[model samples]
Target: MSTSTRAGSAAPSIALNFDSIAAARAIVPRLAAISERSEQLRRLDDEAASLLRGSGLARVITPRAFAGLEMSPSAHIRACAEVAHGCAAASWVLMVCVAHDYVIGRFPEACQKEVYEGDADNLIAGALAPQGTLERTPEGWRLNGRWQFGSGCDHSPWLLMGARVANPEAGGYLTYHVVVRQSDMEIDDTWRTLGMRGTGSKDLVARNVLVPDHRAVPTYPTFIGQSPHATAPTYRLPVFAGLPCMLSGSVLGMAEAGLEAFIGHTKSRRDVTGASKSANANMQQRVAESSAEIAAARRLLESACDRFDVAWRR
Candidate 1:
């Protein structure tokens, strides 16, 4: 299908679905198994990545036309939270993957087709920070430089890189999104961290990789909703409006995981003050407070997502 028509026809609905929750549950154990390995290796294991792909968890934010679930932002948030309950790094990777799909949807239809049409389930990894240089080339442009914090690189088949095209006439830099196949670039294993180690977020280097004009998107234009893609109602929605909610969902999930651990510890813990931990007023109060905090955070996230849906409808 043509990219424009496919984008228009595949505009995502704002409603949440049961499948998203089910996917979250099914992937939680897989995340747990790989959590330790990710920490030890400072990256996600191949097994965990495959499991996530098999679970269709990565498709939550993918456009429906691309065989994605087209889940509402709220659903995406909830799912990430559930995954974070098992492993923060896994949840973070899932959040980034889903967000990257959303960003790709906002690109020119040609770009979308080039990245997703052949293998709708292909994993894409890279940092969004604009740190590379773009020099004009005959076909499109040659991208050069390095980007760090590329999460899920070990499992991704493609990388989405951000670079600046120097507009001498305009006397400024124009940020652009460039797609490079995995083979064209190098992945550096430098993901040392105190937490969220399984993310495998390292650095990506692109040296004079040629990208076609159809595949390069100007970042600023997208911010104002001037994407090359046709304006479907979904496309008309603000660029990156759903991203923060997705990130917050992962944080909320990790918090929930901490709460669970606290509960487990308290159940059998003895207070240092001689009182039974569960019987102590302070411990009871802490448990109540944590539960309330988690509940409040969930409500806030859902409310924000609800607002995003309402905005999209307009």
Candidate 2:
């Protein structure tokens, strides 16, 4: 809900200008500077949120029609990993929010347009687990429920909440993501945890919120890469396969950071015997092993992404 009416995707994104990984790297310093502040605030601070929006990293998986870069899976992974180098909480927020945009792409064109009316980089907060009910109505659907883990909701104006809809024809319930303005639901500040506090994974309560038919998207089709609005191969990559790759980037980044910290600590660390860890053969071996393992993980995750990219292209 970017109400200011400034709409334009970055100019004809060429390879170098639209490199998501580089954009993430540019914001790394700022993200690190505010890491402690974000933790203390129990959510991403204003500056960090601004940095994420300006960096354009969240648009990697967004649709091209809405000024999204629509980059490949590998690119998304690399960008998240880069952000994780500075702060894992920020990385998780970036990754989850980007995926939310991708999900928006799955909605009908009308809904996508309505959601992105103000700007293309509009952020969407989501709670994946289905815990609500949608009752049929003349105007649209009435959504009611209490959902948890609404990550990144502090910054997003739009929210995609999962709910169950009754199917009269099939006599069963189907899962749907009801798109609603963030203000439509009451946000509860219940996210308190020992780690990753900056994610702001709060709880949301919705009481008879009206969701238009176009904005309610099915879960199964999107899961199987069959978006009504998104016809491109990128959106076609079933989330069951693609989401794991997209979310894996943060873990990979955390592992890389852990490796870097170990290397830095050992460089000047002395053992109990007063022997320099850097000079000790066993410590050196451990360092090499950790470095190799991290590298291998990066390669493995990227490789999986690359394969998905290739399949989607065909």
Candidate 3:
């Protein structure tokens, strides 16, 4: 069953059945095993990328027509959290890749088909900062700029890069976005980060690449819920509004992992004075405080997801 479809397209009658969080959790062992290698490479290893793609977690926001999950935002957050429990870098990359699928759904139908057809598992990486300079051309827009923080670009075949277009009528520039094939661009290995090193969020450079008109989109419509092409309810939500929830899942997951590690260490740890850390009053208090904080963070994330789901559904 193909799961790729265009924006404003109708959802399939039968829901695509899959446990997104379960799928995420099942991959934790492999992700954990490769954490050190991923960190060392400053990017996700090819094995880890293949594992994530094969797991179907990468298609959480892809249209059902393209054999994607088309999952809700809340579900996506939950799934991301589960993935982060194994590896933060992997989870961060997943969040960007999956979210880009949703962003592409807001573009023109031709652009959607160009990326999703013949490749149901196709991944898209994106950089939303308006750093590109767009020039009008006979066929379409000519984009020439360098986009940074192109997360998961190492594994992507396409990219949605943000740019600024000179508006003759308005006397200034308008925010524009273009979708381009990765083959048409150059990748610079500049992703050196203290955290999320495995995401491979390097810089992508495009020089005078002509993006077809069908592949270009303005950011205003999507940001203000005014996209005439976006008929799906998911596309109607404000773009910036849901990003916080997407990022919070990883934070919560990391907190959970830290708490677990601390407790495990405390179980068999000795203080400077040769006392058992887990048995000491101060150590016990710290552990209790950390556990409480993690629990509180989980509740906040759940509440945020609940609110987003309710608003999007309505």
> Which 10-residue window of candidate 1 scores lowest in summed lDDT?
9-18
- Cα deviation at 80, candidate 1, in Å, is 1.0
Who is ahead in lDDT, 1 or 3?
3
lDDT by residue (54-103, candidate 1, tens digit) is 77777766655566555556666777888887778888888887777767
Ranking by lDDT: 2, 3, 1
Q: Write the per-residue lDDT of candidate 2 for residues 1-314, one digit (tens) a residue.
A: 23122122332243235888788999998899888998999998878888888888877777666666666666777889999999888888888888777677778877878877556676678787789888888888898999988888998888888888765343133888878999899999999999889999999999999988898877888778776666655666777776687788899998898788888887888889998889998888888898898889888997897786577555
Q: What is the TM-score (0 to 1) of candidate 2?
A: 0.89
Identify the leading candidate in terms of TM-score: 3
C-alpha positional error of residue 5 in candidate 2 after TM-score superposition, expressed in Å: 21
Q: Give the local distance difference test score of model 1.
A: 0.75
Model 3 lDDT-worst window of ten: 7-16
- Each candidate's lDDT (Cα)? 0.75, 0.79, 0.79
| TM-score, every prediction | 0.88, 0.89, 0.91
